[model samples]
Target: MPSRRAVLAGISTGALTSLTGCVSTKRTGATPGTDSNTDWPMFGADRMRSGYAPSAAAPRSSPTERFTASLEGTPIGQPIIADGTVLQSTWYGIEAFDAVSGELLWRFRDEEPGDTAVQYQPPAVHDGVAYVGTESGLVALDVESGDEQWRIETASRVSAPPVAGYDWHHLYIGTIEGELLEVSLEDRASSSPGTVRWKRSVYGEIVRLVAPNIAGVTAGTTGGEVYMVYDGRGLWRTKVPGGVTAMTAEQGNSLYVATFGGGVLKLRTAAHAGRVSWHTEVGPVAQGLLVRAAGAVYGADGGGLTKLGTDGGRERWTFAEAASTIPAAAGDTLYIGGTDSILAYKLSGGTGVAGARIDPQRWQYTHDGGYASGVSIADGAVFAAVGDEPRLLAVE
Candidate 1:
């Protein structure tokens, strides 16, 4: 097989066409639940929700489609990689597929004989299990068998993506009613698998939650509140200019926030106090997304995408295209899911073009339907789920 660079070089001269048939490969006995160091196992790529895949070997030039598979339902969020399987949560259920050949592995649904469970957030995989937030509460399913291991019901609906840490056997989840609940997954091997460790009310709808490798949790609320909590106690709370739509943390100390009111703010939270380190109005919108990678922070919304320096929040570059979801980064290329396609941009600018509105457009993959979720990179494949016409495409 040709190297990824060689493959790109072979097709760099022109736009690639949409793949006609799905690709299939023989199974290699790789278990979907087995954790791999390079896997994009959750949203934002880690417990910190930084959306950076440092170890992944991504494309250096234009990429071509590796496979495409139709999904059972519309995907709710970005698809994640678990071991060698691609997992996507949809309105009807969750579907798992072979990442290499786009083969169907298994399906897990909350529907029972007479009742159906509704979920709105993506799942986080840890220790051979997938944890998801549903309207009722938290649900844990075995990654290999798609079996329900256990569940814990909460007072409100969990509407935000979950974060799982390897350091502890606990899963952190956010609800629509401003509750941050930590559920212990230590008893996952038993018949009764989960227990709510603690819950804290941030007094507003919890929009996002990050469980850093450190000893605390950081939450962003839709009511413009950012809270730092440790051991179920509020350590510090501060207000931002607008409702927090997205947040990314750098090593658990520097928290970068994107707001609906149109700005990005960096907060210093190392000493259990929330202090604004720097703030800038660089085009972040009401439904913004942030990714901390390549020594810079990328913020995107419906309007466009902006790149800012991490040291002092300096504006680096701006792409005047609507970004519908969080961007992903690997190596020197940044991938953004746009209104009608997945666009790639170079992190470094050309000489004599410092802070130029121009970004070297690296590659573009256009789909008939718009993107339903953000782009995810794993195992040399870029996975994107499409909207209206539900399907998942793997580009290499």
Candidate 2:
């Protein structure tokens, strides 16, 4: 395989543009039908942020690269797959591409020539609209044509990804200034976007926001506090030992939170009260998303990737790779993106004992850009953004 830089250097500007144009015609400008069971939508599969694809069957062996497409700007979040299209949020704008052929479909830019609107998080797509957050505000665009449907300005920078309610009738977003805004979907139907259904202020900068299994929103703050809100009122607040780094993942009635202070906490998200069931110190939690699978909760940080038993929060297994991105799982196979390569691991044995370990024989994909933004899997294919220049890599 050629180095990423070599492959990129070999392609001329005209040739790349021509290839992009060829793939553009393959798109029909219609919203592609979606298979909810196989699609990896939202930040971590769903509002719970589980980062687990239950219906996906990831390749058992290391897969070969299918294609790579360059983007306009840096991608700081995971790419979302739906309706045969892959949606990516970059610093400059939001882009859509044909999922199988690596063709550019459409691009949406909300900033002016000299204006700056940094979009570092993934966009949540539901029905036919893609909701994305920018430094200035949130914007909704048509998934098929990349046309702006509505734009709503925020009081401050919108840094995290927006999540849709379970009913798909509401959108939840948090800002850097600690304001959580709930936007009405019915208002968007009436051509009124940004209608504030309700807004609540939390204690510190809100970095990770998720909608739990219960009726309200859960937000983790930079001040190490997790706040649960219903309507416009605070329901419960729990302080972790350290600053919260990522969104919480839910299983049954439990919420799993990763903290920078080197621990993962299991809490109950019922009755407007969050009660910690167990707190297991696992290295420093990564500043990305946390994943739950089988009977374990997986987290990564500067220390490495650690798996803790979901029952009593016991350490199951730890891999010594410095990871800052969330891990994705399909079946018993877990895929993690590290600083330079994508690794494949097998979750062996039953519920207890050491479950996950790196498959030393499995083929690993190496790139010059490094796998910084994480990985996502759908329909037997693995998707990732590699290197600092960031090209979307598809493997199967």
Please list the C-alpha lDDT of all candidates, in the order they appear.
Answer: 0.74, 0.73
Q: Please, what's the RMSD in Å of model 2?
A: 12.4
> Which pairs clash inside model 2?
369-387
Model 2: ten consecutive residues of lowest lDDT: 24-33
Best by lDDT: 1
Model 1, residue pairs in steric clash = 260-286
TM of each candidate vs. truth: 0.84, 0.84
For candidate 2, the lDDT comes to 0.73
Please write out the lDDT profile of model 1 over residues 314-344, one tens digit for every residue: 8766666537576787666678787778887
Backbone clashes, each candidate: 1, 1
Cα error of candidate 1 at position 331, Å: 1.4
| Candidate 2 wrongly placed segments (more than 4 Å) | 1-37, 115-117, 187-194, 349-362
